[model samples]
Target: MKRQTHQLVLAILADLEVYLKTELDNVVIYDDGRGNEDVFFRITEKEHLPLVASLVKKYNGRLVTLTPNVIDDETHELVYHFDIEGLLINCTITVTDKKIPSITPILKSADWTEREMKDLFGVVPEGHPNPKRLILDESLAEGVFQEYIGLSDAMAGAATNKLWEHINEAKRKRD
Candidate 1:
């Protein structure tokens, strides 16, 4: 039943890759090895977004949601979640100059997704209409905040609070 649908999705993905000549692999399907059925896929980059979207349409799949995972001081990647009929799939794509492609063109829902990816991961989606900061404060300087401020959440919070305290103290002295 469920296994049949999962197999169908894998087949459709393989077929789509053939038609698009794109690198779409790292297909992962998880079901806890139990009664529940869950499926997922790990994509390559933005270049495959269109092909993925096309496959989704051709197979009656739906783009449910996407999230950009920024690996601070290392690598950044985007993870997309899709639901095909009754099967759920998750795909992760790393951002690279060679393969980085924009998904905004294929799905309007991807506009902000791309922007947020750029904002947090610094992966610029080539054709994003508004690739502005989605999570970061636009008023702050680029990378500087993340550099001198540090990357870890605990460290960043402490560092930021200390910096603000110093600024506030300096103002008090003047007044």
Candidate 2:
């Protein structure tokens, strides 16, 4: 049953590729050696992200999460995970100019995660209805996580502890 469902999803994705006139790179079913399989594909063009989101919704798939990984100083990768008929699909889009189209308009559940990618990774989600910071203060610079990568473990821990202290103080004042 799992194999058949996976094949059906692949067929739909192939149809989408043909309809969109775009190629999906690294289209494969990855097995985790633990009786789990996930369908993964990469969208080389960032513009196609929203269109894919719309199609996923039309097919009754729900957005699971959006994860962003910094590739280099000027490049990032955004992976949009979805669950369709109990099969997990991971659609990845590469960002070169630190900007990508927001899928929140198509999937409202993507709102907070998109904002989080913006705040933590500095990847701006253009067209997001509410593009405000989700986890970090506006006063602090964006991509705080990236900035701490070069720091020593102790230094990073200290910085994180200090930031948490500041956050706690603010919460106390608000209360």
Candidate 3:
């Protein structure tokens, strides 16, 4: 049954490749060795995210989660995880300008996750219905986490001060 499900997912991805009129990059299938498999692939273009979401919906898949990771000062990666008929599929897209087309418009479940991503990573989800702060206060700067991650101790010293300033300001507002 697991083999059949994996084959079905591969076929669906193949169809997606055809629909996009190009081949997908970094495609990998990992079997957890415990009767479960995960399909991972790179979307290659930010504009194609909506199309990918639509295709996943067509296959009756539910968006499981969306995660944003900072690759460097200028690059961010968004990973969209989905579950289709009990199979896990992960699609990743690289964003260079800190903006990517939002999937919230297509999948309502993505609304909060997109907002959280915006607040944490400073990656604007273009076209998100409600792009307001979700997990971070407005007083805190967007992408606060991005600034601190992977920083040298010297650089972190500056970031730490800035973070404390924001925290102190937020605290004062409540008093």
Candidate 4:
């Protein structure tokens, strides 16, 4: 019975692919904790996001959230994470020449997710109207998040120097 249900979902996705225009690069399906099937797919740049949303609507699937991740390379690839009805679908799209396609036009919910990706991964959504810093503030030390990741491996002098810089900067600003 479970196998049959999985096959049915695959058929639906395959049908959606024809209209999607781009070939489905990859597909991953798993059972989410909520007893619904979770599906992830890597697809080409054809802008099938709204189609996916429509599928979610037809299936009564909830639109959970969207997250974008950056792949560090000469041409960074943007991975969009979509959670629909407990199923996580990750779509990876390549950006050549630092040009990222805007999904906010398709899904209004993609606004903030694009902003976060911009600040953290340096991937700018081309059509995002209000792209602003979401992670760091004015007072945050440059590369603080990156530095925090390496805090455990930082040498004593390096740590102290960074700390002193912050302290002196604070003092200088106040004085």
Best by lDDT: 3
**Model 1 scores what on Cα lDDT?**
0.64
* Model 3, span 79-140: residue lDDT tens: 99988888888998888999898888788878888898888889998999998899999876
My TM-score estimates for the predictions, one after another, are 0.63, 0.78, 0.80, 0.61
Model 4: colliding residue pairs: none
Query: What ranges in model 1 sit over 4 Å off?
Result: 1-4, 20-25, 32-36, 72-74, 96-99, 135-137, 142-175
lDDT of each: 0.64, 0.81, 0.83, 0.60
Model 2, 1-175: lDDT tens per residue? 2245656676768766875687766888877665466888887877778788888887787789998887888888788998777778898888899989898988988899989988888889899999888899878778876754545765765767865776688789979
The residue pairs that clash in candidate 2, if any, are: none
Error of 2 at 11 (Å): 3.3
lDDT value, residue 50 of candidate 2:
79
lDDT of 1 by residue, 25-56 (tens): 56556665543456566665455667777676
Candidate 4 worst ten-residue window by lDDT: 141-150
Displacement of residue 80 (Cα, Å) in model 4 is 2.2
Candidate 2 has its poorest 10 consecutive residues by lDDT at 1-10
Model 3: pairs clashing at backbone N, Cα or C within 3 Å: none
- Model 2: residues with Cα > 4 Å off, grouped in runs: 1-3, 31-36, 149-175
RMSD to the hidden true structure, all candidates: 6.3, 6.4, 5.4, 5.8
* Shift of residue 94 alpha carbon in model 1, Å: 2.3
